[model samples]
Target chain A: MRNLFFFIYRFRAFLIFLSLEVLCVFMLVRYNTYQGAAIFNSATTYVGYVLEFQSSVKDYFRLASINNTLATENAALRAELMKYKDIEQTDSLNKMTDSLYVVTDSAKALPYILHAARVINNSIRRTNNYLTLSVGSEAGVRPEMGVITPGGIVGRVKTVGKRYSTVTSILHSQMLVSAKIKRDNTSGTIRWTGGDYRTALLDFVPLHIKPAIGDTVVTSGYSTVFPEGVMIGTISSVEREPDKSFYTIEVKLAVDFAQLSYVYVVEDPHREEREKLERDAGIKSDEP
Target chain B: MNRKFGFINIVQFVLFVSFQILFMDSLILYSTAFCFIYVGFLLFLPLGISRVWILLLGFITGFTVDVFYDTMGIHAAASVLLTYLRPHILNLLTPRDGYDTSDTATIYAMGWRWFLAYAVILILMHHAAVFFLEVISFRDVWYTLLKIVTSTIYTCLVMVIIQLLFFSGKRANR
Candidate 1:
């Protein structure tokens, strides 16, 4: 007993260190799996509601721009109505209404993102930055949806509440967005360099991809977090090494985070069904 | 007597943890605030406190910061290590029996040189461990090393500033 106590006392610090590290590793491993993912879902929804309430006050200022966008969309809709009438005058009225209703309902079924949120709690200064949006689950905000401003991609939903949701911004070091260059078919990953909020680094593009400065970068839609063809940023600079395999590209962000007042969260109504099918097919969704 | 200090220390721990998670954490300016306050905790440890309590305090301090940051157990691991090493540091600076029982470890009790030496070593160790674990999450060895050095420098500077601001006063001799 004396020898055992002596041995333990001599290495107590080491034992504590080992035990704590092991505990942390265990927690980290557990958190990375699906079991813990659902645990955050409820808390996220409650927090989202609170965040949305806080943001509504700031979002009032962006009403003019949002109104103008809605007005423009209305005018475009009217023009399309006229074009449809001219193209299909001989169709039966009942059939026309049914078809038109189906198309509109189907568009709505695509999960029309309705709420515009203002960022009240923003964190562009961290290695893993999270943005708080003022819209919540009560306003139809859900987890795994995409949030973007007219400027560009903001981030995807991490947690949702009745009135607010938290977004993991693209500026985070852990955030990875599937992006492709406009001029070429080649694609790569976009990740932040852990310092600048207005720029990101593109990785994995091959030397043969032929990228240049001013090339537009857009979402590749390889992941469900965002739809295909959404603008991400533009390549501001490119550094090609004499003996390297990939070009180091610097991208200028499209969103003016400093001036940001409002944003739209995109919701895919078919997300659950699509996810189920994908999982059944042994495919995993790339989420950050 | 120790129990009374323990209650005050718990309050301090909670305050620092809350400030780190809810306020400074929101600023997102590199999460430097937590790193700053962590040094402050080390500085505030009363002279003659048991070695086990020091390590335990360090563990709690680090674990609190980690829970909010969502980095799992990295802070806790580093903090426990810091606590484990604190006694060795205290021994180097002041003989075990030389320090006043009621006197706090302040810049006034130990000269600026000893205080700075102790603070720098502990802060660097904490920062190095944190950055290494965080960077290694993705398996980038060289990148992690660069982060360790740079972040350690930043954390060390902030720790020094915090020490200068809060713990510089001399306590009455016991």
Candidate 2:
């Protein structure tokens, strides 16, 4: 017994080192799983407050550009709203407002809810990138909800605190967005393989589709995370390796991740119902 | 260490950690080289501090940095490895007359040559561990290697400049 105690005492430092390292690895694996709520992330109250304060101080320099972007977006939205209003007026003049039409329109209006939030912290240089937003559970932000800028799709909420949340950015290695070529509607998975923050790879695009450079890519809405037709990016390069059956296409992302300030967290109201129905029907629901 | 030195070390720890997360976190050069100046705090700890204490400090420091970076354990793992190897690295670079009991691992106390060797070796190990652990694969080995080399150079240059500007003056007064 004394020999055992001596052995342990002699190697206490090594033992401590090993145990600490193991604990870190365990945390890494545990917290990295999709949608897992981690207690120690940047969204924690104190860290979020510090980051919020720092970004607030830095936001003064970005005010002009942010104003310009918001102005342009407002102009675009006004034009879209005008078009919709004209259509509504024409429909009313035609007297085609049936009960079924009203039902469908109301159903469509409630599919997704948007909450505007400011990005307090964002990182694109890391292999697995994440963004911390200034809105969280108190503001109705929840894990698995989609986040998007006015320009393009951003990422999904991974964890939420009282007034803060962390998003697994589209640049993350494990993140997969179901996207389709806007021209042909051919669908594939978008994955970022590190290095460049501005680009990602669109996988499983078959050879016959013949995708070209500058072809717009948008979310396929195959999953409940994003609404149909949200902009992702445009294809920049397409290559066909001899051994592979799929085309390796690179996409230049639309939203500049580095300059992200304001975004909308998208919550699908029918996600639970759809998921439950699919689950009961024995459908796998693979896309996320 | 005296109470004054202990208090100074505590202050330095806070400064290093805050500076790292607030300023250095976003200060990447050319989207490739990252300056992790917090490692400087670990590298300059008093030589005679217990290894167990050093290990705990390393874990705490790295874990704190990790929390802000949103990489929960990668920093902690790399930092623990760095602290675990610090004593051996110091032993390997022991000067001809051996280390003074009062010595801290500052460039002002150790000569430039010794300090450079020590810093480069330990920082290289730390960066390699961090980048590889982050990537978790051999697919992008070359790119990861480039990041490791560039970040090591970047961190070492910053650490040296900080030592020259701050620690050198303090040592002269002593």
Candidate 3:
């Protein structure tokens, strides 16, 4: 025992350094993985509170722009409401003239639910950026739910807290959003090449599709996370690689990430049903 | 380790950690370089303190910053390595009269040339470890290296200005 103690004392500095560094690296690897990301992200209590406080202070500076956005959205909704009201009034008038006539399907207009959230902390410089929002599990936010703005798709929920949630922003290299060309409906995947936040790479698009520059790209609904037809970006450039079969396409993202302050968490009602059908189909195919 | 100096060290630790998280952290200059001045606290530990205790102090300071940065342990890992290497580095630069432990390891006490070399070396090691782990991929090796270099220079500049502002060699000799 004395020998062991002496040995440790002799090499105490190197030993201590090794252990501490090992512990730190261990924490880095453990938290950087997909599973334990929730506990270490900024959505935790103290940092959450501080960032929320800072955002609240900054939120006051941008109230005018926020109000403008709200007013524009309200105007669009009101216009749509007027059109719907005209149709409903016409239907009701016809129903009064002929008894037993009924109006159906208005209650099921949307397949997903949207919850409004304020982004408390946002980072755009990192290759894999994330945003912390004031909404969380208590607000019905959950992992894998799609997050978007009034303008375009944002990202998916990575981890949820009681009062906050972290979103793996679209700028992340690992993020793969199912995207399609609005004109031709040709599908591709949106990926970041770790350089530009305003631009992203569209993968798996064929050379023959011939997407014109400025073509609109939107979510294709292949993944249950995002409902179909949400705007992603507009094509900025396209190139056909001689060595590869697919076209190299670039997209200019619609949402200005630097100014991102508000988002809507999208809850897909039929996501579980769709995933279950796919799983059961896979099992049946495996039986052969 | 007189009780008075120990108490002063405790106060410095809190001040350094708070400065790092509150001020340095919020400055993301050009979206690449992040100046971390807290590492200066580890480098300037009272002379003759046990190397093991220095490592622990570095971890504690780094962990305080990490909790706010949400970087898990990247800062702590780099800090431990830098703190453990400080003694050997001082020995490498030992003057014939040897290190005067009377004054704290302030830039003013250590002379501008010696202190600049020391600060630059330690800051480079810390920044390299931090940015390498931060990017975590060799695919963008040049970019990560650029970030490391810029952040190190930025940190060293901040340390020099801080030392000139508050601490002076004449005062440290007391």
* lDDT (0 to 1) per candidate: 0.67, 0.90, 0.81
Q: What share of the reference contacts is kept in model 1?
A: 0.32
- Going through the candidates in the order shown, the clash numbers are 14, 0, 0
The segments of candidate 2 whose C-alpha lies over 4 angstroms from its true place after superposition are A94-109, B1-5, B169-173
Model 2 residue B75 lDDT score: 95
Q: Is candidate 1 or candidate 2 better by DockQ?
A: 2
Quote the true-contact fraction of every model.
0.32, 0.80, 0.69
DockQ of candidate 3 (2 decimals): 0.60
> Higher-DockQ candidate among 1 and 3?
3
Clashing pairs in 3: none
lDDT of 1 by residue, B1-174 (tens): 121356656666766665555555433334343344555665566766766667777777776665445455667778877877787887887745677555565566666787778877887787777776665466656655665666666666665666577654653233
Q: What value does the lDDT take at residue B121 in candidate 1?
A: 85
Candidate 1 docks with a DockQ of 0.34
Best by DockQ: 2
Question: What DockQ does candidate 2 have relative to the true complex?
Answer: 0.84
lDDT of 2 by residue, B1-174 (tens): 311337778888999999998898579988789999999889888887788899999999999999999998999999999999998998898889887765678777777898999999999999999999898888889999999999999999999999888886466335
For residues A55-89, write the lDDT of model 1, one tens digit per residue.
46545777786578657657987999999887777
Instruction: Candidate 2: give its CA RMSD in angstroms.
Output: 1.9
Q: What CAPRI grade goes to candidate 2? A: high
